[model samples]
Target: MGAHQITIVDMDIVETSNLHRQALYTEDDALNMVPKVHAIKEHIARINHHVDVQTYYQEITSNNIEDILDEVKPDIVIDGMDHFKIRYLINEVCHKHQIPWVYGAAVGNKGTVYGIDFKGPCLKCLLKQMPSSGESCAINGVLPTIITQVASYEVAEVLRYLSGEGFSKKLITIDTWHIDFKAMNVDILKNHACEICANQHYSLLETKHQQHIESLCGRTYLFRYQSSIFEHAHHLPGEIVKSTSFAKLIKDDDYEITLFKDGRMNVYGIEDDEEAFKLYHSYLKALK
Candidate 1:
C-alpha cells in the first residue's frame, strides 16, 4: 500500500446503487454526481496525503490509451475494468510496453486473480477469444464481500511483483459464499501460438476492433462515438437535466443519456441490445 504515485482512469459517475460495494464513495458523492476517478482521488488524498494520485476523468479507448500510458509511465498496471474489451486493450498495450499487470474479476460470489509479468502467459494466452456471453455484476448480482476479497488478493499480487518476489503463475479462484478456493497452475495454459504474447500482435489496439458500445451495470449501456456531444447539444431531442463543461445529461421518456465532452455516452433504462443500438444510431445521426 506504500506506493509513491498512482494514476486512475474512469468515466463513470458515482451512483447510490453502487455505494454498498464501492466503499470509497458516499451518498453525498452520488448526490453531487462526482466522477468515479475524481471521487477516488479525493478519497485517496484524505487517507494518504503523500500518495500522488493522478486522475483521468475519461474512458480508456484505443485512441487515448497510448497517450495516457506514455504520460503515466507506470511501473505496473492493475485491472479494475468491468468489461473484457478494455482489459484486452490494456493487455495489448502493457505487453507491448513490457509492463507488468495484475488481473482481477469478481461476479456473483465468484472471483479470479492472476498476475502477468509480460515474460510469461498474458491474458490473451489464457483466453484465446472473448467469451461469447458477457456476464456482469449488474445481471448476476455481486456480493460486497467478494469485491473486497478479490481486491485484497489483487493488491497482494501487486506487492509481490513490486518487491521482486515473482508471481505464483497460478490463477486464483474463489467463491466466498461457498467458502471454496482453488488455484490453477496457468503455466500449462500458456499458448505458444498466442497472437499477442507470442507473435507480438496487438489486434485490440487497431481502430477496426475498437469497442464502441458496452452494456454496463444496472441496465445501462455506454456508447463511445467519435464526435463531441457539446457540438450537437442543441440538436438533441431531450430535456436537459444537467449541463456542465465536461458533460451533459439529457432525459427523455424512454432513456436517460449523459454525454461527455470526449464523445462517450451513458444511456440508462434500456436492456435490449437492439433498442440500445437504435438509440445510439439516432444520436449519431443527430450529431452528424
Candidate 2:
C-alpha cells in the first residue's frame, strides 16, 4: 500500500454494471463514463497524494505489452484481468524479463491466487494449456466480498515479494460462501519441459496469435489497430458524446464508439461480426 509509484493500465470505461463488484468507481464515474485508468488515478490521489501515479488508458495486447513492461520496469506485476489470453502473455513476458508476478482471479465466490518468482514453476507450468472457457462474472455473477478478499490477498503477496520475504510457493483456493480456504504446495507443478519458463520459448508474444478484432461480453466488439485518432479527428461521423485527453466517445444511431488515441476502438450495441467489421472498415475509409 505504501508503494512510492504505481502504474495502472485499462482501456474500459466505468459502467453501471461494474458498481456492484468494483469498489473504486462511483455512480458519478459511470454516469460521466470515466476511463478506468483515469478514475483509478484520481481515487488513488485522494488516498495517498504522495504516491506517484502513472496511468495508461490502453489495453495490453501482444504488440504493446513488452514495450509497456520495458518502459515501466516494474519491480513486480499484478494480474487483474478476467481473461487468460492476456494472462498468458503477461506470464511469458514477465518470465522472459525475469520479473516476479502474482496471478489472481475471482468469480462466483471462488478465487485463486498464485505467485511466480521466475526461479520456480510459472503459470504455464501449472496450466499446461489454455483452459476451456468457463463461467464468468457476466454469466454466473460474483460477490463483492470475493473481489475484495481476492484483491487483499494479491496485494499481500505483492508486499511479500517486494520486501524480499519470498513466496509461499502454494496455490491458494478460496470459496468464501462456504468458508473454505486451502493452500497446496505448487512447487511440484514445475515442468522441466515447459516452453515459456523452462525452455524460454514465448509463443504468446507472436503477432499471429494476437487477434485485432475480438468479441467482448454483452454484444460488444473491440477493434484494435494502432493509429492516431487525432489525425482523423475531423472526419468522425458521429456526435461526440464525450471527449477526454486520451480517448473520445462518439455515438451514431447504430453504434457507439470509444476510440483511443492509440486506435483501439470499442463498439457497443453491435451483435454480429460482419456488421462490426463493416463499420470498422467504413471508419477506416473515412480516416483515409
Best by lDDT: 1
C-alpha TM-score for every candidate: 0.91, 0.85
Model 1 segments more than 4 A misplaced: 136-138, 208-212, 231-234, 285-288
lDDT per residue for candidate 2 within 70-111, as digits (tens), equals: 899999999898778788889999999999999998888899
Models, CA RMSD each: 2.1, 2.9
| Model 1 per-residue lDDT at 183 | 95
> lDDT per residue, candidate 1, 1-288, as tens digits?
589999999987887888999999999887767888988989999998999999998778888999999999999999997788889989999999999999998889999999998888999988887753346656678898998999989999899989889777889999999999999998888899999999998977876455567777767888888755577877777888877666778888888888877788888898788988888888888878
Clashing pairs in 1: none
Q: Which stretches of candidate 2 lie over 4 Å from their true place?
A: 132-137, 208-210, 229-239, 251-255, 272-275, 282-288
Checking candidate 2 for backbone clashes, the offending pairs are none
